[model samples]
Target chain A: MAESMTETEQRPSGVPYPGTPEGRRGTGDPGFAPHDGQEAPELLERSRALVDPAMRAAVESLPASMRRIARYHFGWEHVDGSPAAGHAGKAIRPALVLAAAAALGGPAARAAAVPAAAAVELVHNFTLLHDDVMDRDPTRRHRPTAWTVFGDADAILAGDAIQALALRLLAEDPHPAAAPAAARLADCVMELCAGQHTDTDLEHRAPEEVTLDEVLAMAEAKTGALLGCACALGALYAGAGPEEVAALDGFGRQAGLAFQLIDDVIGIWGEPLRTGKPAGADLAARKKSLPVVAALVSGTPAAAELAALYGKPYITGDSEGIARTALAVERAGGRDWAQTEAADRMARAMQELARAIPDPEAAGGLLALAEFVTRRSS
Target chain B: MAESMTETEQRPSGVPYPGTPEGRRGTGDPGFAPHDGQEAPELLERSRALVDPAMRAAVESLPASMRRIARYHFGWEHVDGSPAAGHAGKAIRPALVLAAAAALGGPAARAAAVPAAAAVELVHNFTLLHDDVMDRDPTRRHRPTAWTVFGDADAILAGDAIQALALRLLAEDPHPAAAPAAARLADCVMELCAGQHTDTDLEHRAPEEVTLDEVLAMAEAKTGALLGCACALGALYAGAGPEEVAALDGFGRQAGLAFQLIDDVIGIWGEPLRTGKPAGADLAARKKSLPVVAALVSGTPAAAELAALYGKPYITGDSEGIARTALAVERAGGRDWAQTEAADRMARAMQELARAIPDPEAAGGLLALAEFVTRRSS
Candidate 1:
């Protein structure tokens, strides 16, 4: 492990360590360590190669209608069953699975974790399909949402099928870790649903009636649980002991929170061309995102103004009002607060990763991925 | 096994055997064997005692918001979280689990199957919650549907949580059968979803476009798969070999088909007070139920008239049109076909049960339960 420490020292000089104070500033750039921008993509590509085939096979095993909907959702086909060169998701969770497995048990562990990686990806897509329907979002990945193309019932059933497929993939695996991994994944899904329930419930409440703590908890449950599950599953597949697995889980959880915090910030200020959504879409929908909740509770004059804007019954096509609310959130210190909180979470994630792997070289891809998640404009 | 066979011979004479020709008529009575009506109630009561608490515990394990929705859906509480005597569904799936275990491995097996029983019940309720929302039905079990009471998002999330809980219960079980049982249950859910997808898809097409074969296949997937899973899980927990487990699955599948066939008949003709919905509810919605599909393909004058009736845009609260359509369906031989098909399925179920248990007495309760399911007015 000590021999690998030199790898961290060799990182490019301009990129601040994610834990450093300079990295805590609202710098737009991720400034990833060393050759991460180049190296991480190759790693992710390799992980995707391992995971995508397995995922395709799983989806193929579904019944015909469900298979069609899943294929369409994954950008593998069109609504009319014609082949399409559509863009799939970034496969971030699968990359994490493989990286975590490699960190724990090296090359063989990475190989063994492929099924787990596929399972996690399937779960991620399942959530996306269902979430898109529940949120009534019209677009994802610069294309029409599955519910819009395939119809809501088909989309919902397809999501259900994919969830079952995830568990089936793990359960059918010959690995000794499969059963436990399935259990963990199921638990994570329950937490995800609970978080979603709270999220939509909060939408019905007055802005001031919601608390930052509640929103934070919801984010952890909704976003962090699955990421933690992916890491834990990878570690489990690597035959790591419970303590190491748990540490990796903690690492992923904090990293997930950091990712959500940054994502929330982007939801408010992201450029539409990059994010594939309208600018300030979250504000337009009056979504009680982390930053929005934080701003509402800030006790500043801007916060009061933001609350008053939220108090008005939302009218359709009120883009200007939504834009003003975004400005109010920023003026109330929500943007800065989210940035600082994300950096702190990244630091905590790094601490947990160090405790788990104890080798910075093995942890390189994980650190890069964490930076990538937080840094992306979309 | 031989001693048990004698118990079957001692059944009273007035109650017809489920396999008898007289039981195949549209008498609207179960014609249960011996003291089945009375004895079955006792068995169901005992099974419920074992399954309900476990189900409650599973629901309670969910987060507070989800727990509230689940409890309310199960009729254990009101919308305000106050206690209420609500009617949960007939714990038929759980009872099948316990009964199958008992038939296969006797008393100890029955006790060992408790977790499997609970898991199946949870899955059943999960499907019910989701199906209710998808169907947009306003009432279930003589009360407003969960979606009406808790909102669509909450109901959907609660349903999702229950499904996860079901898998969790099995995965966490110490029994050797737990992993396989969980896998089987997940597969059953996938099939159920596929069937639901097909059902909704068929609804979008002209009634004549749907074939009897397709309707039967959907019923088998939607209803039979879960029942089969329940029996297979029970047998698995009893440590039965694959052959016996498969036989029990066949038995349950056939019985489930019979139940569905009868249910389709009831949807057309059953009393509103007993069924807890308006009379001819399926007809009113222009639902492509099994009998209706069968009639559409019958090619009689009545079939054409029924098609014309279905072609019209359905108006809400048009009970007279629904009643006329129901009569047309009967005139086209749908009623007769369903009755014969149900009897055939019941016979097939009995044959499979005999192959598995090898003792008539061991099958008595199973036969009775099958009869009860097919005979119920509700």
Candidate 2:
């Protein structure tokens, strides 16, 4: 599954802001004609409507001790435990699962994969909870991270229980595909863990010690693996054979990589109002994100300057320093490289999607999703 | 599954040290002999032989970054990653799984349950790794804890991977019972997380605010739940009916409670030489172990003294304070209550085992293993 979809349907339209660098603004839209001529939000909303019951049931089934924290994390309850309208992300991963199922096996397979979709979402949130604790991240989705609210031990426990719940959902399912889905999901979890370990390990070393390849691999494992697994699971539920499953997985993984590249770009230039995180926070923390690594190894004068700036410790409220650092990275060709890399990855993703489902009409929902995630915070 | 086995076969013989109180010094020995009169050590050793490869394969399958830390945690390799003779534990949990399977369906059942057995052990180690981090414990199995050897982040990631591996093993097994067993194992993990959550929550509160019943429930959840699940999984593999599986689960849970009660007692009164940890370490940390809570709520005069002593923060190397604290617990009848409670639990366990497997000879291995754990630290 590797480049036959038209460039117009696979390219993202870039949004320019104050921090958006030259050569990256207003790129062409990935002109996907979604199902029923619908968009990603519609597909996501439909998927959410179908998957919400299963997700809520899984959360409700948790023991009281863990249920409270999970409820808050999922945005279904306030910190005080009162009900709230859920704001649990765009529900993108589950949408991917449902879309992939629909593409291969129609509505029936999509419905059959509900438990698995919920399981995938649960895994994503589980990693989020643990990652917040490990990274000492203070906020997520415009609220205090669970560890900051319930304390680290409780947050960790909640995450542990959620992971179990995820597996239990599949294990208890009568669907024949459930067991293989579980094994694949569990394997994804280990990859996620290893990715996190590498991320943390890399963070402690000098910027020069970290390679672009290493950071890319870390991103793939950390971010791409789950997306791949979700799509693979959807294929399994649809009774798609091994080749199709692998192709779908590759599609998701490539899209996920493009998603990461765009996400990293957003981490540097995204609007706070849209992204729910402060602009340039990653740079402020001296995080060795993909663009930063790319710029560091560019062998240019600006790369040296960027390296020197990163060598020094970041101080709080150093907005001036952050601005200068962002400039150095741009001058070192980071932003342009990231934009090009994202387009390349999305093209690869389109190839995989086309290989798996040759008809554009059948693949509309998935095509919309991949484009949506890549363009989400632009 | 209640009260049918002979009393002599369920009671554990006691070993006494200077700290052992008068009432608990030499309780009568359990008289049920092991298969071929081999006893627990032989059974455990044999089971270890059977399950070790599966455990090793699971660990080795981990990604390179996590594998190093997991290897160190399992005592299979040193911190530097060179090989070492494995000292993972006594292999008790897996042994129980094998024993229960054999009791129900003989050799084939036991053999089929190997992956489940390895999965259980992995879950146990995963919990240990996280608990050590949360508790900030400096040692485990007489060596530096994983969190201390690697940083907290790496240890946590390793634990996370091991847990995923645990479920993955069960998920990958082709046996008919694997799905149910994985679901059961995952459910136990949730219970384990909740138990740990309660334990951490209780640790931050005043000792007097804690109740005996609360601690008892916590102990059962933390220690007994997995043991019960292990037995139930074994019974599932053996094709046992629901009633028989429930009985075996009951047997394991009761025995687990007894194990915890004695472990708590040992935490407060055993010789450090045998226990491999300081005798008063739990007391020094003001841990709300089973006996400690029992003593605190005793309503005896010594209970007040113990509470007041526990109220003051412990200074390291205060041998006099530790001695006084141990004596206070004893005088308040914590020791006596624990011994009596353990015996009652053992009796209940015997009843469950007899109900599930009426033939004493067939049940010999399980009986011996249960008695061995209860007596090993005595």
Candidate 3:
């Protein structure tokens, strides 16, 4: 059993801390010690050490300038070229990949860890780069956007390069499911493009023109598809049965949608300083976020006034007005509605995992992961 | 032997005729023929039969608006959906793909024909779409550009969709080398992107600021890489030996470069009515064409006057002055220099093919193919 665990359990080194509650901060120790709540930390630490270099090597294969951008975006560098190594993200997406593979009966999941980790990270960063361009905002994770640093053309290329790298890394994996995983990843990428197209189109529309269902559809295609891909690829590496893959896909889809809902909520109501953003940032931009859409549909007096305000071009000092509108959404049950939906999604994800995993002990970390994503501040 | 022939021989297309001999008048047929010196009408008919539908399928994979613009650009439809097919292009690129595969050796080549043919055709169209955008040109072949009909965003997306479809089609091939070929195709795509970046960058630089070597490097990356991908992919599908693959890569690269040089010549000196373009188009745009570069280097009085003329910003009637400049290039032996270089490249390409392929009969068609590309009009 010990030998089997050595072969089957691991996380990438940049993952910081795996399976430990203390390391959940977006920043902390670069040294990760993966644990199973009861398992020895040394065993998990060794696994992470083996995977980290591989992840870096895969990322380094990209074009030099793009690699530099990715390195910075991943929080490995400060703007001034110093080694900051701030919060490098949760690594939850890749963890899902490795855990799903293990839950499925494949021992090859350990070998897949580096690529699995790198691919998800790349996908996340690709979105960030493009979203920054589309949103026309300057900073990300407390640093200048790649577009801001390298110019829009180079930033576009950087995103393109990272997307290509993700596909290439997955292709290079020796797992039997590499081909299918690649096709799925490509499909996910296309979905991202489509979802973004719709989002851009929506930006020009009136507030009342947007709907909750449309927001959900956009969220699924833009965010959920990639998360689903991560889980499906993990299952693929594990040689999971088709049923298991399907269940995990469902789980990931729900979890991703829920994640987006939480993000939307935070975008409107989270504390500015803690979020490293201005209050009511999405509202100030007149973004058709989930809660805003919900409020529009509710037909309250506040909704009517908000619609009137959104009809005009917002000027300076209008952010406070948008925050007042967000408050109306809270009063109108939009926040409550969003939170309920997230809880329902979390329940669905857990239920699917229960059905697919067979071994409940392996799933504890995933359950914690789901909670972490839904409730975390940053 | 019958089966082997079936594998290795492309039924010759009738005759190659594109537009008209006069270049200005529009002709329904692009002067397509069966094969060189072979008046097999069935071969021409079969080649068309194989290429047209596959090209349609490839274009249909794009988004609807993109498909509409692409169809109009291909001369398959008017902006309002009126019938308009004959003047689009000769589909020569796809024909070359099939011919190269058949000229190698394998029954599998026949199975690979549609996809390999489609791949090259899509790539060619992709370049045309982006070239139209980057060059800010209004027409291609003999009709309005896709961007003229569908807007820049749609045109860009159409080009992107074509690239994706080309790679996807190649990936679906069942040959053992298909995976490696797909990888090569992806690498070529990155090169194409890099070349476009370089071209866009050069747009802001003065003619004196652009170096000859930079022009050559950009040409190789943008044009030669895709052409090489087409040839190498065809050879791989045909189950050709490693030597043949390497030979095809060189053949494609050289042929592509030579083709570009002739294109530069035509862009400056060809009759506008015949070429469906303004005479001295490149010069009018103050483009850093080979002849222009030669004129810059020749140190003649006429060359200096031409440089002065090129130094001024171009307006509508500047094409006449550009033509006079092109005449200066001919007097300086630049046109002759370029033609001789083309011939040299063709000879070198043939030499590589000869060393790689021992079958004289099979080698004959490939060499003829090179001649057709180097000397092609319109």
Candidate 4:
């Protein structure tokens, strides 16, 4: 699929694909931050107080080798069990859960505490583990994949455990609505699995096999559902009104879609050194990403040529061909098409943000959080 | 491992050691008499009302290939879309769910309907599908495995989708306690995964290498958890007290363990012409089963010889050796040990059954259920 890369010049060179370390993006607004310098320690302190014990309890229940791999993935254990501060993820998803809940008027102190934070974090990790296995990925967060370490079965089982722990924590919470929260969480998990199934199916199909509608549906199932659930559950915790819960869910849904498109862009054209993933890795894998699909549908000469090359099965040592295909896709307006879509999605997300009736400042903070997610560089 | 067949009375001629159907055991307690005589038609009617719709809906959202395999496994489809009444399982577990809920004073009407029944059944099917893949089984329920028809990936994704559907159904139930019920179900799901991990590991480890304690733990994790969850959820649905819930869970747990031990016996000494699975199949696979484990710990000379024979990596074609090993294990008191253990476990299970304040008539029915499970013959 060929798309003109010339019109979209603001993109940074190197960022890892989604589900990787370099994929982390935050708001570009200079004035916006997760916390003021003074707030960082308290947030970290509070987070650690809750996350550590829950994580330990969950992992301890796992088999030894599985625990080892999970620990390594979480930056808690080295391959050889020596002390090592491994690359902990930014924990953005969990932070979003807390921030959204607090923004909905709950005390940040209890809203963002251990069990919830740990639940959300574990959900994120569970997805990472399974996604890596399905994609046959070998590295994540700039380290070897968990499957590569503990073997695929152990990795899968560990991931499954993390998912269970997420639900278990929510159920065990003493909140009046703990049961309802768990029910909501289970629905989101179903969406996650459905999204993944769609994603996996895309690989075996033609480049033009999936439509924009399908992509949107897939995004809703994959990324949007989780983010929306995060916000909705947060609002529930904060005792936010029904309208506010609905608004935040809408906001998260739109923002999550935009986030996925931006991440897709980064996967293809991003710089290898910065991303910590091989350059044009997505192209080499011939992933049926949005831009590639867009270009394939455009019917331009460049698109035709690119599609011709992609019609064949993927081969090793063909990264150069894949790169050329990527270039052709760019020349055909695919890149511009995706960028416009992402911006539109973001605008709608902000519109939803504006409809919220929470405290203006807290709402503003959540809005800033959304912006941070779509705009950040890894 | 060197123990001779002459040392034990367990060995019998005309009982195929491999490549022959295993035997089934029936309790002869006439447990299903009450339901079978008057309630059978109504149960089927009620089940069909819920099961048909839920089963259709669950697969409706899945991709075509996944749907195909699932439909095939459900005995709903063939390769050419011709009408095929596939081998639908006995649906014993779902019946247990409904019966347990009904026994706890819940109406067996909509409460015992499709989504929950289908969900539990799908969970069982999900396990079967994956177990087939892991055990390298080529057949299930007397037919080719799903993997044989749809390939490993499709079979896996199908199983995964069904699992998601199970959770989704539980979460979406309109009952007030649906949320908590779902959370409990997830706990069971996680335990099942843990059990599967242990079971797979046992396959790789020598049969005698693992201890009886470990085997019991594995059995509890693998089979008991789901049964316990099913019974507990059913009680929860019926508005049963926490005490009742705990008792039902205990009942299912003990019965499930006993079921496994009996299953192990069938796998070894079954009548080859009756059970679809090969007789002594577990022996050929050198599975680290209950009886095998018991034999290893008995400290008899025959037990020592059995251990040596089991240590060999390959036993696929050594049917004679397997028969000899089986006989030696019996002579060493392994068979007796296992039978006694099974009986003890069954007694314990029945003890739990005694705690429930079931209708005296229903109490006998429940006991019959337990006997049927643990002492079934086919």
Candidate 5:
């Protein structure tokens, strides 16, 4: 594994080079070999251990009802306020925050970035709670979504409270970097809102009228902005210069785009059990996901068929139609295009990381996180 | 008018002592006389001029679609993107922010408080936008509410964006007080969410099951917290000590409570044209407003009748039922109680203002604004 980390040219081109079943399913890129997956999971566990207490403390600061809703949303409590061993998220963003801090300013800097890591995690969950309500998605992380359990108003309010708490945490931090960190996070939130607005607006338009560039911009705002902010915040807290912070932000943005591309592919073809969603859920809803959009604009015969299918009203029980649409999207080369784009983005991400931290040892954990995000079937 | 400003004891106990037609209808408290309304309007105009440019600049920083929605919400543009002459709001919160700053420090301090003033105004409008969506209110400031025109998702997203922008403005300010200002603003937002959560929860339960203390706490959270934060932020910006800031916060809190009490009275009894809402609209929705809660506990025959009426489902378009309920609330002394409470709060507000700023001349604008808020028919 150490040799593979040093030998960047021999690393997997697109997929995670770790011995998970899904990661091992990579296209046969030359000289690529799957290493044991122990390192990534251990790092993730460490990050969670480091960040969870602060995150929990932030959620606990919310008023009673909101605190209950937030705790439940974080999988820390049951609906009845009893402790529950539910699945929290993978803590990927917080991991990136800590890793970036450590990369820039070593261990003490990483510790100083703990509040920022928790803040980013809070912002991420805030988006999830609101997104679930806005999209009317009933489930998340294999559990009923907060909106479904707490009712829409409470869910939305919880999201709002969490977002405020994120900023409050940063603003109250004694670190000099706190002010700029808060400003950056707030800017990212506005971008997320703009992206979500554009996404919903696109859904109301004809498939043929939407441009790929618009979709990509929306994806960057909706997904990449927060990830970039997470990394930038960590660097800022580490007392890194603006250029270093910007470099980390760029790295995270490319990785985020790659993550979204792979996620779009998985949405079409991933096993529902692994993804923890209904089979072909995106296609069933005729969602304008990246792969589907690529297909609709491909100008192939299958592209026309896919567009026609998307134009029709998507009925809830029409699994057959959904499967057919997914097939048409793949036939138009949307799946392959997304896969290639993901690989390209991954390469770009590595380039940015190298520019920011020339030492391969410092970049190892961030690279592993990027691979983990892209390689996850879920 | 100057003599009357010094003759505080002879001021009207409940209503505003400004020379408006509605103000002239005040109950005959001995030796009370309406002063010319010119001072409050002039002060409001000055405050708006001071705060609007900063507010506009903050909104302009948002991305395009969100910027458009926020501008529209602020009455700066028509839905078609043309400039409009729509009334934004009374700008009361921003006025309080500046007044508090000037009262603590000199006029130069008011200029220094511009960002804080803008921040508080943004927070105020953020709450209004969300409240309209949550209550499904169709009209605000004599025009269609943002949610009605822009759709619920956009209105909500716009509100979220504006809120983030408020904190961003504070964080970006070069003032030493920016960090604490941002923290205070964010904390107030959480309280607002908690209050809103309790409010919605109350709506789902029988009125008899809710206590006046609970309702008052909700009101303080929903209304008084932000007002207090605004004043505290202003005082903080003016470099006031903690005790002075706390006193200003107390002043704003009592004024805010008085504001809510008068708003409840106006909701049920004010003229529709003046209030810009249907007469007895609160009764029409059977909202658990403070006056209604007071009347429910009054133990009068009218209170019993009101309780019986409230026990039934509130049918939409039941204007007759709403009017009768309003009459019952008044007959049970709810109106009288709210009026007395408002007067008591105003007295407390004055006391706190005196503690914060011993000179009555410095306190004149805040006093006038408080009287205006509680006294205005709208």
Candidate 6:
């Protein structure tokens, strides 16, 4: 694994990683702002404004028993059922949908894709709820996870209901693309389930037994599939042809991979105050994240040292040990590998976007969104 | 609360209840044969023959990680990845879909409805998988449940995937009714979630704090909603009018309640050999089943005694205590109330079926299915 990624290769200190409040990325773009005068943040804001009402209406249709759990999960309500300033994610998926729609078919297509946008957002949250339960995640968006507050059964039920509601939105839409969108979205859910299974299954396996390819496939399914489907659905709504839809899907998938790579890098190196967790929290949890796995398989002297550190369970407040492990990985070229791979993936994403839209101006919104996603925490 | 002839009202032995090999019901009509030359079992058999292939094909489409769990849950495969003599329950929901279609629009409609039939069955099994996880059920279809074999996370993921597959089937179908069916099925899923929440929540509540109406509504939501959706989907596929679809939904809902009522009675009184559980197993588990809740809420002297017995948890090997508890519920008129209510629900189901299809000959299959469901067990 230590091919060109040797200790001599280096990246700048500050790289973009996902900056979700929960220390993890799920449904949204989080709190990132416009950079380099890009329209990505503005586009995301517009997407959220458009999608939130539809999402709320869809959530309202859930049975009262499940509605409370869902509302709280969405950051729309407190545990006591009182209203709250919603901190629902930055509508990255919805923004992708609308941007893709507009890129190919202009504003009318964007307008027509609103329900599908909401549907994608709902699906994202549904996965978040279930993933929290499966991973036993205690917090999300800097608050107690739905499972922690409502218990496993309720969390699971709420996720199930939300997923149903998501597909129902597409199923009920009068748009000609609705059925196809539902089908695509449903396919994405299966991919996601399989991805989550692979994820949890990998966590149980010995680190040496897992390949980098396996990790990449898992990340692609877990993180890339939905993003790709969101763009694909938008293309369908825009009356795009098969090739165009496929290209847009490719674009989103590569962008999503870039996002995961950056996110994983940050998990090892991001500031504790920003990520809302202790530095190297993934390391402390013994999570087989991208860089850690990359470092372990690097076949260098430091790879052995990193593996030795990973073999032992993390001790609480063992900052010195964490620092040593981080140094070992850096020496083994894991950080450099991740950053290089992320940049490569982003380049591929842009190529795919251009392949479908040819015109740079038409693809600018999507291009900006993709860049924002890869920057300092996608 | 019971205000009937008290303990004087008695049901004869051998009342037909759902005779699934598993103690609980979810997907199928189970292993009962035709009664009085009724076509219910025959219809279920044919429906299974038609729908199983579609169901299997859809399940085969799941990712390998989830496919094994689903195959095992459906009793198509064993824990070690070996094939089993498939004991997938009687295709009651699929049978309902086909029978309702056949009743309203003949053979063409029935054939067109096959995909919907499979979709309904998939949804049913999806719920079964998740319910097994949430309820910590050890066995299903007389085998170890998916969760017991694969662990909680995999089972949950498989369930999630199966639900998506169900919606995908509808979404991909070219039939005009597909969208409406997906919408209704999605709504039913939400209702099922709410119902399951109520079921678990009620189980945690004190016996005296629970009410009969609450249990009834829960049963309707949890059990009846899916059945109703199955029938409604069938109706939609048949190009039936709103009134016909509504009537079929009502018909299935009432029949499902009857099914639950009979199932609850079987819980209290069925032979251990038949139920694959100890006598009064539900009582031992302190489940707030329909009859038990009715007894608790009954304003009778025996109600107090039954409540007192229910206040304490049952000990393992305490058959005598279980018997005593069963008798207390019986004396509180729980058995009579359940049987009478089931019969009444069956009558209402018949009324709705008649309204939907005035010609008795045209409705024979549905009539038989409803009768089969409500008989001693549903």
What does candidate 3's lDDT look like per residue over B1-378, in tens digits? 123222111211122211122211232322322234322333334556887787788667654545676687778888898888564565655655665676785435845666777767776776677667666788677677887876655565555555555655654555565566656666665666566667666666776677767776777777777777777777877887778888888878877777777667767776455456556777777777765676666667766776677788778876566667777777766666566555555556655655555453454445556555554444
lDDT of 4 by residue, B1-378 (tens): 113211121221112112112311132322223333224435544555556677778767655646677788887777666768754765656666666666666465336434566677777887787677667788776778887876665666667666666766765566655666666766776778778888888777765568889889999888888777767776777777888888888888887887787677777776455556566777777778888888888888988898888887554677788788778767887667766666666656655655664343444334445555554432
Better of 1 and 2 by lDDT: 2
* DockQ of every predicted complex: 0.63, 0.75, 0.20, 0.30, 0.76, 0.79
Can you write out model 6's per-residue Cα lDDT over A1-378, one digit (the tens) per residue? 222322112221122232222411332443222333347778888888888889999999999999999999989999999999966867799999999998899989999999999999999999999999999999888889999998999999999999999999999998999999999999999999999999998999988888888999999999999899999999999999999999999989998988888778777776455556566878888888888888888999998998889889999999999889888888998888888887777767766776788765577677678766765352
lDDT at residue A95 of model 4 (Cα atoms): 58
Instruction: Give the DockQ ranking, best first.
Output: 6, 5, 2, 1, 4, 3
In model 4, where do residues sit more than 4 Å from their true spots? A1-69, A80-84, A108-117, A174-180, A208-212, A239-246, A311-323, A357-360, A376-378, B1-69, B79-83, B106-119, B174-180, B238-244, B313-318, B358-360
Native-to-model Cα distance after best TM-score fit, residue A32 in candidate 6, in Å: 17
**Per-model lDDT:** 0.80, 0.85, 0.63, 0.66, 0.81, 0.83
Clashes of each: 0, 1, 25, 34, 0, 17
The digit string of per-residue lDDT tens for model 5 on A1-378 reads 123222221222544323232433332423123233325666678889999999988887899989999989999988898999965878889889988888888889889999999989998999899888888888888789999999888888888899999999999998988899999999999999999999999998889999889999999999888888888888898898988899889889988988898777767776555567555778877889898999989999999999889888888788789889988998998877787777777777776776777765566677777777776644
Model 5, residue A338: distance off in Å is 0.4
Query: Which residue runs does candidate 3 get wrong by more than 4 Å?
Result: A1-92, A105-107, A123-137, A149-151, A171-174, A376-378, B1-48, B51-92, B120-163, B170-173, B298-306, B331-333, B376-378
Clash-forming residue pairs, model 5: none
Question: What CA RMSD would candidate 5 show?
Answer: 6.0
Among the numbered candidates, top TM-score falls to: 2
lDDT of 6 at B185: 95
lDDT of 1 by residue, A1-378 (tens): 112112222222234443443542333544545253336678778898888889888888888878988888899998789998864878888999988888778889899989889988988888888889888989888779998998777777888888888887876777888878888888888899988988887888989899999998998999888888889988998898999999889988988998888778767776456666566778877788888888899999999999998788667888788778988998898877887777778778877877887655567777677766665533
Lowest lDDT 10-residue stretch of candidate 1 chain A: A1-10
In model 3, how large is the Cα lDDT of residue A363? Answer: 53
DockQ of 5: 0.76
